[model samples]
Target: MGTPTPPPSAAKIRRTSSSGGSGSIILEKYQLGRLLGRGSFAKVYLARLLDNPSAPEVAIKVIDKAATVDAAMEPRIVREVSAMRRLHHHSNILTLHEVMATKTKIYLVMELAPGGELFAKLARSRRFSESTARRYFHQLISALRFCHQNGVFHRDIKPQNLLLDQNGLLKITDFGLSALSEQKIDGLVRTACGTPAYTAPEVISRKGYDAEKADAWSCGVLLYVFLVGSLPFDDGNLSNMYRAMHRRAFEFPDFVSKSAKIVIYRLLDPNPNTRLSLDELIKLSWFKKSFSQENLRSQGSDENPTGSEFLDSKQFKFMPRVNAFDLISMSSGLDLSGLFEEETTSSKEIRFTSKMEVAEIEEKVSKAGLEFQYRVERRKGGAMRLVKGRAVVVVEIWGVAPELWLVELRLVDGAAELGESQWGELRLGIGAIMAQ
Candidate 1:
């Protein structure tokens, strides 16, 4: 960890007051402190939960329904919530602690990343050394890998949307532009969204492009920006910039290492099909210098890394009932519950929606070393049972809301063998398999 980067001097951290019953100005549950940040659609404030004074302060996103000019934007807000919730608990992604909506507005309670955007930090230091850039790049890749695993793609992967916590951890924020991997037809998305400079060639082509590869291309641009303090294909003329991006026109300063340049070249490949996949990118000599194959191999083990035994005395909490839209966006990420969901009477489970065919999911699960018995339960709904020694895991995947499959996981093991560490490791394992 390095010196904590200070936030922007112009951040509007003002004290806001609301009406109270006794003519005083104070909100009900949260004490709104300052304006932490803002966007076109909403504003974020630094606030604390009234009941839990000792709890960490949060960044509350205020989205007023009346602020929008059209009724259609509400669905996009819903989509943002759905996308954020689906990515819950990812280390490199911002966490949505709570979602509260009133008739007039929706309030989202989120974890605060006080260190501000990586862009601001870059501005202060001019540019990061290769080691520093490598560290942040690793987090960016990991977060993007997790998103891709869950079938989510952050179409906008710019520095402005990337924030750093006090401890120097990078948190990927702003899901308004995120989309489910299967939302497109034949894995080709028609919309050309994202900042013009960082946009992938295929996306600019408008003929349709793979969202996953588009994300990879953005990552390439990000790494380049991090290492070199400027845009690779930047130009005053929009046509020239677009032309440069399509032709993969970018140069490395003499200071950039050969290994890093190789990774960037593969990532910025004009053809999405030839773009280096996450698995391939991670194995690069330069990138792997930061994170190695040893840790990757260790994540698949059933044992905890720590020597202590895992005591699962507390039952795990199930998520609140979700609307149909959220249920669909989360199907891929929820496969992780088999590793972490605590044991209880009423099925300890996690539910998400998946676009992958049942046959495809089943094939992946089987290849992961688990044996299962697939059963048909009513129309468009089915269940799979897997048993190991005496430990049994039940998975139910049902079709809902047009081709979407609702996936539910239940653990039936009376004796809990895995704890937080083990479960986290298991999530990495499952995520890797799903990314394939």
Candidate 2:
């Protein structure tokens, strides 16, 4: 490690007083402290468990329910919960100890990694020596193998999402984009999602892509960055970058070793069919160097340790009060040729704020659909799917704040049947009902 990046300083960390009662107590348990990180809809705080002197400090991820609903990040949260719960057995995977919720917020109690994000470390160090990089890469591959063996696919794998503990052990975090085997339709995942630079070509193509192959491509990108200190396909233009990835346009620096070059080449192959699987990659000579069973076992036992007692205590129940919604707008009429087609041009989305209660909003939407002679069917998570002839629409209600709600109506399918004028009429009809 060169010129280590210091941990988040006191000046940067904001203090948040845990609401209600006195003296920064949350749910009569943990005491909130410095803010670890902040994002568009959430903030992470460092906290300590009350009355448990031996217990370690934890990171409390505080998500504003209203903000999440506004950003359509409900599905991402649900996927994270599901993925973490399933994959937390591995030592290299971040542990989600417990979950809590209030009327306005959702809390995820997670294991603390004081070293912070791996990306931050790489940024300061510029690049790692071959042995150092290989060690980290081994841990990543091991954790990823464990995930795949358990039928989980971490769709997003990058330095930013990887964390490091105080001992410098790598831990994979952020399962917001992960996909479970059960989510597969006809033995393939069709969702075209992930960081543009790291995403596989097949995924960008919108054709059904194998989850394992997509992940391998991302791993290749990460490996190149570890030794080269830069992205393989670095371009200002999104189209040019994507084109480079599709054509396997990248070269290794002269400093990269021969064995590392071979591994990277096999992994970065544009054709998914020819890409090396995680199992095959692990057996490569470069990966096998300085690697042993002892290196992996050094972290600790594989047995699941008993989790926080409070997480299981009867006094507390982890139920997410905020409803999770799928943000990805599915379009059957999408053109497969374009990798970055603008959804604004095809997807009709409308949002309005109201003082009405959730039930009142639901009723008004139903009444509006009835006026338009559209058959309304209730979908999971309180969404209404309306169909009439070949026109299809989805209406959803989200609570943004106390006494205020956001009503959203999106035209998801059959855009051809619902022309611009008809879609406008549908939106206006709903608006009229709510106005009453």
Candidate 3:
């Protein structure tokens, strides 16, 4: 048999430009660009394949191995990479192009969502109409169903992690907390991890729980947020919040349609055994209405029971895609989470822009090391570091545009002794050289 045509996504990956390059290039395949977002241990950047003008833009997630190891997050990171690689075929799931790593850093090249996070959109619009909410809900459920059938469970489900493409299609991301079937002990998952408001009560109870059922609970909470613009269960006190979740207590606004309410109610059922199964969910009257059959592909023989097309004549109404904005105060009801707190800049951090080539920046660091009696070393992933008797400084170069780069120098260790003078001299030295 002619090798069954590789999936469309697999074919695209095979056609990506081969890797080879130094300075601003990741493994010679992708050239890194402006920072898209940052977390405690990782930074996501916009990037594109080198030597291929028609290559689509992608996001490269650069994870600091040292930082993650220190925080005991190495296992979680590994699980995320494994799960995404196995589950990228679904329409609503984010696509991970490839993963590359060095001794100190791991890079995950993935499809970029130009439309940004769903959380940001909801923040701007307040809440969606019933029909609009149903559209997104249908897509999200379809993806969740696929994940369940494949034995991967996304423990965290929220608007912040649900992204949108240019056409407003929902894409699920951030699988760091996901659980695979092989990881289970005695056919059950015992880990208690997920966002407080979105976690299932069974998980919070510390008793082993069904991975798929916990994920189903989160899906319910997500749908509630999409329609109400707020969390279903939240409180200033952690105990109180968990208590509310145990009872599955939440009220729908007058605007929520009866059918939508029924769906949410079934999904939020505290008893995992009675929770709406994926097979049952799609058949629900609410989920079937106006759902675009073309958007959902049958996964197996049992997926479409009748093997007949959905007869709904109404076209799926497309919601307008909007720019993302910082989420403001969510004091609508029992809001207590500091989740949406605005980010603040620190006084010690310094940033500068330059037109110098990446190689020139490396040369400057070498000269600085000689002038200051420090050892200049090259990190496996194209980063540079200066070490003087354990006082270490890390330098990274990010390409923002052609001929323009943003270089960041951070003091990693022995800050008290090297405080201003050591790094200051190095910064001034590098800046002075760039000024030439």
All-Cα superposition RMSD per candidate: 13.5, 15.0, 20.7
Tens-digit lDDT track of model 1 for 155-252? 89999999987777788988877776436664467877788788787786758788889899899998899998988889989888878877878899
Each prediction's whole-model lDDT (CA): 0.61, 0.69, 0.66
Top lDDT hit: 2
Candidate 3 TM-score versus the reference: 0.63
The residue pairs found clashing in candidate 3 are 20-28, 21-28
Per-prediction TM-score:
0.66, 0.65, 0.63
**C-alpha root-mean-square deviation, candidate 3:** 20.7
User: What local lDDT score does residue 231 receive in model 1, on the 0 to 100 scale?
Assistant: 87
Count clashing pairs, candidate 2. Answer: 0
